[model samples]
Target chain A: MAKGTILSIDAMGGDAAPGVVVDGLAALLADRADISVLLHGNEPVLAPLVAAQKALAGRCQIIHSDTVITSDMKPSQALRRGKGSSMWNAVEAVKNGEAGAAVSAGNTGALMAISMLILRKMEGVHRPAMTALWPTLRGRTVVLDVGANLEADAAQLVTFAIMGEAYARAALGIAKPTIGILNIGSEEMKGHDEVREAHEWLRAAKLDIDYRGFVEGDDISKGAVDVVVTDGFTGNVALKAGEGVARMLGSRMREALTASLMTKIGAALAMAGLKTLRSQMDPSNVNGGVLLGLGGVSVKSHGGTDARGFARACELAADLASSHYRDEILANLARIREGGLAAE
Target chain B: MAKGTILSIDAMGGDAAPGVVVDGLAALLADRADISVLLHGNEPVLAPLVAAQKALAGRCQIIHSDTVITSDMKPSQALRRGKGSSMWNAVEAVKNGEAGAAVSAGNTGALMAISMLILRKMEGVHRPAMTALWPTLRGRTVVLDVGANLEADAAQLVTFAIMGEAYARAALGIAKPTIGILNIGSEEMKGHDEVREAHEWLRAAKLDIDYRGFVEGDDISKGAVDVVVTDGFTGNVALKAGEGVARMLGSRMREALTASLMTKIGAALAMAGLKTLRSQMDPSNVNGGVLLGLGGVSVKSHGGTDARGFARACELAADLASSHYRDEILANLARIREGGLAAE
Candidate 1:
C-alpha cells in the first residue's frame, strides 16, 4: 500500500476469472487509497474489465500473461509448463520484489509449488507451512500446516510453532501469541513420538510467545491458544471437518427456523441476529491461506470463492505486506536456530 | 433385548457413578423386560443404588468388585492392577460369555486396554478400530478408528473398512453402506502411501460394501459416504474438531437468538423446531464408541454423560450384540483375507 509497495493479482485463476478479480480489486480500492495492484492475466480479457472500473484502472497496472493455470492441473505439471501463467507471474512478482505480496484464487497445489520454487524457503526453515485464520468463540486463531506437507518431524513442528507465533503477531495483531501443539489429548505423553518431542522442545525453548504445551482439536475453535500447530495431514482434515460441522449446523438451524408458519415469522424477526452470526462463521471473511516460512508472503484463496472472498484474500496479503511479516518470521527463525531449540 | 442375553455394566465408572448407571439400567428395563444386566462395582455403592430402582434391581445381578478404575489411571497401570475393578470385571463378563456385551463409562484408554486384553482380537484382525455414529445431514454415518491406535498401515486400514462395513450393516441397518477413505483430497495421489494403497485395495477387494474411493473431511457430514475410514490419529482429531465446531456454533446460535427481545420471542416461537434440531446435534444421542474387531461387543460411553446418555450407550451395545456384529465382522474379515485384498 505504501510507496513502491504492490500486491500482484492472479486475474485469471479463479472460477469467475478477471471479472471477479476486477470487482474484488475495485472493492478493495474503495476502502484504501494507497494500495496499488499489478494485475496479471491475458490483456484482451483484463483490459476491458479494468477499463470499466475507473478507480481500479487508475491504481492497477496490467501485466499481460497469456497462460492461465487450470484448477485441475497437477502441481508437477504446472511447474513444468506454467511459465508466464497468471498464477506464476503473480508469485514471480513477489519474488522479484515488484510486489510486496501475492494473492491468488488459484489451484492450491500449483500456487504452493510456484510460491516455493520462486520465493524459496526462509533461512533454516525445513518446510514451509500453510496457515489459515480459523474463527473462534473469542476471535480468530492461527492454525498451520493445513496440507503443506503430510507429515512433520519434531524439528518441523517446532519450526511451525515459531512461524505460527510470528504470524499471529503480524497478521492477527496478537502480541506474544500463545502457541499449542495439536494432539489427541492434553497429556504430556498423549500423541506420537514427534509430537511429544516437540512439546518437550517448546517447553525448554526461549521464545517471545507463550508456549502452551498441548491442546486437542476442539481447542482451535475455543481459542485456547493463539496459534495451533500440527502436521499438514491432521490440520487439513481437522479444518475441513470443522467446516463440515459448521455447514451442517447452519443448515439445521435454518431448517429449524423455517419448519412452520410460526417459526417463519420468528425467522423474519431474528434476521438481524442471524445475519451477525452468519458473518462471523463465513469462510469468505477468512479466505486467505498464507504460505508461511517462505522468504515472501503469498496467500492462496479458495478457488471457488466469489469476488467478496477474493477481496478478503487481497486484504490479507496487504496486511502481511504492511506488517513486514517476512522480516518478523526471519527474526524469530534466527532466534530459534541460534538457541538450537528445534534441532532434529 | 433378548432371552439369555446380558449387558455388563461398570457401575462405578462415569462421572455420576452408580446413580446414572442404575438410572440408565432402569430406563432400559422400562422398555424391554427380556434384557438382563450384571452390575459390577463395590457392593456398598451398588446395593443402595440398585435397591432404590425396583425395575433395575429386579433385572440386575450384583457382581461385587473391590476396585474402581479411576479416570486418570494409565491404561497400562489399569491393565496391571485392575484385576477386580468394576471396569475390568465388566469387560471380563463379556470375555467369560456371561454377558452378550459390555458397556462402560470409564477412562477410554483403560477400557480399551481391558477390552483388548480380555475379549482379545478376532481371528485375522491386525488391530481393532473404534467406530462412532456421526450425525450427518442424512441421518447418521459411521466413522471408524476414532482412536483405537495412533497409526494404521494399509492392511489395518483395509481391515477397518471391513469392520466398519459390518458395523454399519448391523447398527445403521444399511444393506450395503458406501465406504470412503478419509484423506486430504479425493485424488489418488493426494495422501500418504498407506492411504493410497488402502484405496487401491478397497477398490479391488471382493466385498459387499460400496467402495467410493477417497473422500475429504467435509464428506463426513455431507452424507457423501456411509462409512468414513481413517487412521486413529486423523479420525480422532476430525471427530473432536467436528464436535468442537458444533458446540461453538450452538453456543453462538443461542447467543444470537437471545441477544434481543425480538430474537428472544423468535426463539420461543421456534422451540419445537429447535428441539428437533438439538436432538439431532446432541452428542449424547450417539454416546457410545464401539470397539470393533474384538470377539465381543464393547461400548465405551462418555464418562461425563448422564443417565439418558448412558442408556443410549447401553442400547448401542445391545444392538451390536443382538445383531451378531462379531460374527458378521468375522465373516467379512474371512472374505477379505481369502481374497488376499490387503496383503503387505
Candidate 2:
C-alpha cells in the first residue's frame, strides 16, 4: 500500500553484465526520488563500480552473492544450484518482501523457471505467460507466451489471452483492447485442432474483451490488434523474427542512404525522419518482457540490453507493482475456471 | 515441351476462388504467347463471362467438371473421392504427362498429399519438401519443407538442405547458395536434439555447397543465408508470418501516408517510391511454392493469388524444368547417400 521502496535487480545477468545494469540503476535512481535499487551481485565484483559513482556511494545497496547463472545453464538446474547467484538472489529479495518486484536479464528459461517455481502462479491462474510489448508502426501491441511455455493446450492459450488483455490495458493504457489469436490464417477455421478449439471457446466465452477472430504474424508490428495471443514456440519465433527483420530493414535503409553521394545528401536532409524511424525500430522503447499470471512481478530485459533497456524493465516493474493487475487477472480467471468447473 | 498446350486449370482452389482464380487465369492467358488455359467448370457457370471477354474466345477452353474440392476437405479423402474435381483432374494431367507441370491453388494439405502420392518423390529423395522463395534484403532465399513434413528427422533435414540448395542455385541463380539450419539460436548447442544433430551432420557432410551453420527464423528475411532448411512446422509458421507481416506493413504505411492533408501531397510526390515499395512487397512476385524433391515439377500458387502470381509460377515451372533441377538434386543426394553408406 505504501510507496514501493526498491526494485531488486540481477546485476550479473545479461551480456552487458554489472556495468550496464548498474548504469541503468544509476540513471533510474537519479530520475526518480521515491524508488531505490537493491543490486544483487558479489560485493567484491560490484563494489568498486558502486564506489566509483559518487551518487551511488550510499544510495544503492549491493547484496553479496557468490554464484552467477550463465546463459547456457538449464532453467530448472540453474534455479536449483545457483542459490547465491545474482538472478536468484534478486528474485529471493522480492519473495522475502525486501523489494516490490525483481528484474533479470539472465537465461530466459531460467528466469521463467525460477519465477514460476518460487513465486508460484497467481490465484486462479492455470499458467503464467511471457508477454512482450511489440513496437508497431501504429503503436505497441502485447504478444503473450513468447517463450515461457512451448507446449500449451487450449485452456492454457485462453489463459494467455486473458492475461495479455490485462497487461495491454494496464501497461499500454488501451481501453477495452481488442484481442486476436495468432494463427496460420485470419479465418476462424484456419489453425490446427488446438487453435480451433481455443477459438471456439474464446468466442463463446463471456468476458469484458473484444475477441477479434484471428490475426497473422504481420499484425504484431503493424498494430492491427492490441493483444496477440499464441503459444510460446510460435510467439518466440515470431518475436525473434520480428527483431531480425527490423534489423535487416534498418541495415538496408542505412545502406541505401550511403550507397550513393546524392542519397547520402538526401539522408542528411531527412535526418529527422530517419532518427524517428530508427527510434521506432529500436528495441529499447519496448525493452521489458513481463512474466504474466505470476503472484509476484517479474520482468526480463533482453540479454544484450544496455542501460536504457534495463531502466525500462525497472520502470515496468514499478508499473506492475503499483497497479491492481494481479487482482484484476485473478478475478477474471476465477470466473472462467468456475464456469469450466460448473460445466464439468 | 513445344509451348506446352494450354494446361487445364481448376479455377477454384483459394479462399476467393472461382472469381479471383478465373480472372487470374484469364489475365495470365492474355499475356503469355506460349500458354493457354482450359477452365474446368460447368459451361453454364462461365458462358456469360466468356461471352463478355472476346479475348478469351479462342484462348479459353472450358471443361465441364461439376465437383469442387472445398478448402476443408481431408487430404486422404480429397485424393480418394475428389476424383473428377478440378484439382484432381489437373494433377491427373501432370501424372499422365499430358501437362509438363501441374499448378494448383487448392487446400495445401490436399495438394501436397496428392503430389507426393500421385507424382511421388524423386529417386533417392526419401521425403519431398514444399519449398517457397522469399525475397530478402540480400537477394532471395529458398525455404524448404514449408509444410511438407511436420515432424522430420536429422536425415530428412539434411536431405531438405541439399535439395533446397540445389533449388536455390537452379531457380534463383545463386551459385554455391549458403544452406542454414533454422533453429532457436545460432549456437551449435541451442535447439532440440534433432536440430543439433542436423546442424552437425550438415556441417560435417562433404557436399558441393557452402554450408552456413544454423540460421534463426529472423535470418530467413535478413538475407544472412541463401537457403534456409527446417522441418515443415517451423518453415510453414515463418512463411505465414512473413506474408501476414508484409500485408500488415503495407496497410500501416498507407494509413501513415493518408494521415493528413499535407502528407497527401507528400504521398503524391512520393508516388514513384510508393509504387516501387508496393511492387517489392507484392505477393505476386514470389507467390509460387515449389514442391521440391519430386520426380516431376509442381508449383503451388497462393490460394488467393492473382494472375500475376500465376504468371510467376508458370515462369518458375519453366525455369525448373529447363534448369534440370531434378537431375542436380538427384546427383547431390546420390553423392551424399553414397558417402553416408560408405562411412557407415
| Each candidate: chain B TM-score | 0.96, 0.88
Q: TM-score of the A chain in candidate 2? A: 0.93
Model 1: how far is B15 from its true place, Å? 1.4
> Which residue pairs in candidate 2 collide?
A218-B244, A218-B245
Error of 2 at A254 (Å): 2.1
* Predicted candidate 1 versus true structure: per-residue lDDT over B1-344, tens digit per residue: 34656999999998998888889989988887878899899998778888888887567989999999999998889889999999999998888888989999989889888999999988889789998889999988999999888899999998898889889888888888899999997232489999999988888778766899988999899989999999988998999888888889989999988999988888788787889899888888888999898878899999999898999999888878889666777787777878877463
CAPRI grade of model 2:
acceptable
What lDDT, from 0 to 1, does candidate 1 have?
0.87
DockQ of candidate 2 against the true complex: 0.24
Looking at candidate 1, what is the lDDT of residue A270?
79
User: What's the i-RMS of each model?
Assistant: 1.8, 4.8
DockQ of 1: 0.65
Q: For residues B1-344, write the lDDT of model 2, one tens digit per residue.
A: 22555465666677766666666665666666576665665568766676676556676667777788888888877878788887777777677876667677878777777778778888777778889888788767898887776567888888888889888887888777888887764222376667778888777777787888887778888888999888776677677666655554455545555655655554555454445555666778888888887777777888877767876776676566557677777787777787773121
